[model samples]
Every structure is written in structure tokens, then in C-alpha cells.
Target: MSEKQEHASAYWKENLKYLIILLTIWFVVSFGCGILFREALNEIRLGGFKLGFWFAQQGSIYVFVILIFVYVRLMNKLDKKYGFDE
Candidate 1:
């Protein structure tokens, strides 16, 4: 294979690893903590909001938005690195 193709393949492999890790964290925090462990977290409160309630209502959504932006930024960087930027 050509050097360019090899580099692109390697870049994609690395990017996929990062994406998987980030997505796993997102899932765990939003689903695990917010839903599964919600009762355990209910004992804590912050700024008039119960921890579990906040996570279920607003925190997860906020995290999802941040994750979207993070994905966009990472993909943009990946595109540039792989000469796929438009």
C-alpha cells in the first residue's frame, strides 16, 4: 500500500478508538448514573437540584450537546490530518 493510504488507515484506527472510548463514557454517565444508579445518587443535592433528578432532566442533555461538539471538533481534526478536509 502507498504511504498516504497507510497513514489514512492508521489515522482512522486511532480515531475509532477515541470515538469508542468517548461514547462509552457518555453512555455510562448518562444511562448508568442517571438511570440505573439514580436512587443511590438521590442522597445528594446541588444548587436546589437533586443529583439524580438533575442528571435525568438536564445534565444528560447538556453532556450530549458537549459530546456532539467534541465529536465535531475531533472529526474536523481527523479530516485535516487525513487530507479529507473540505
Candidate 2:
């Protein structure tokens, strides 16, 4: 492949890596904390609410937002690295 094509391919691969990692984190937090591990997490409390309940109702949303920001930052760095920032 040409150098430019190779760069594009690498950039796409890196982007996919970032997406997979972030989505997996989100899935674990939402599914594991909210359902699978709810009973275990319920033993803990945050601001008077059970941890698992909070994860189901609010924590997942918070995590998703945070992940959005994290993805933005990561993408910015990736863009710069790949000369795509322009």
C-alpha cells in the first residue's frame, strides 16, 4: 500500500481500538455494576443511595459522559499523531 493509504489504515485501526476499549468499559460498568454485581455492590453506599442502584439509575449515564470526554481527548491526540488535526 502507498504511504498515505497505510497512514489512513493505521489511523482507522487506532480509532477502532479506542472505541472498543471505551465501549467495553461502558458495558462492564453498566451491565456488571447495574445487574451482574448489583447485589455485591449494594453493600456499599454513595450519598445515601445503594451503589448498585446508583449505577443503574445515574452512574451509567455519568460514566458514558465521562467516556465521551475521554474519547474526545483521545481522538484529539490521535488526530495530531496521524497528521489529521488539520
Top of the candidates by lDDT: 2
Enumerate residue pairs that collide in model 2.
none
The CA lDDT of each predicted structure is: 0.87, 0.98
Question: What does the lDDT come to for candidate 1?
Answer: 0.87
Clashing pairs in 1: none
Please write out the lDDT profile of model 2 over residues 1-86, one tens digit for every residue. 99999999999999999999999999999999999999999999999999999999999999999999999999999999999897
Badly placed stretches (over 4 Å) of model 1 are none
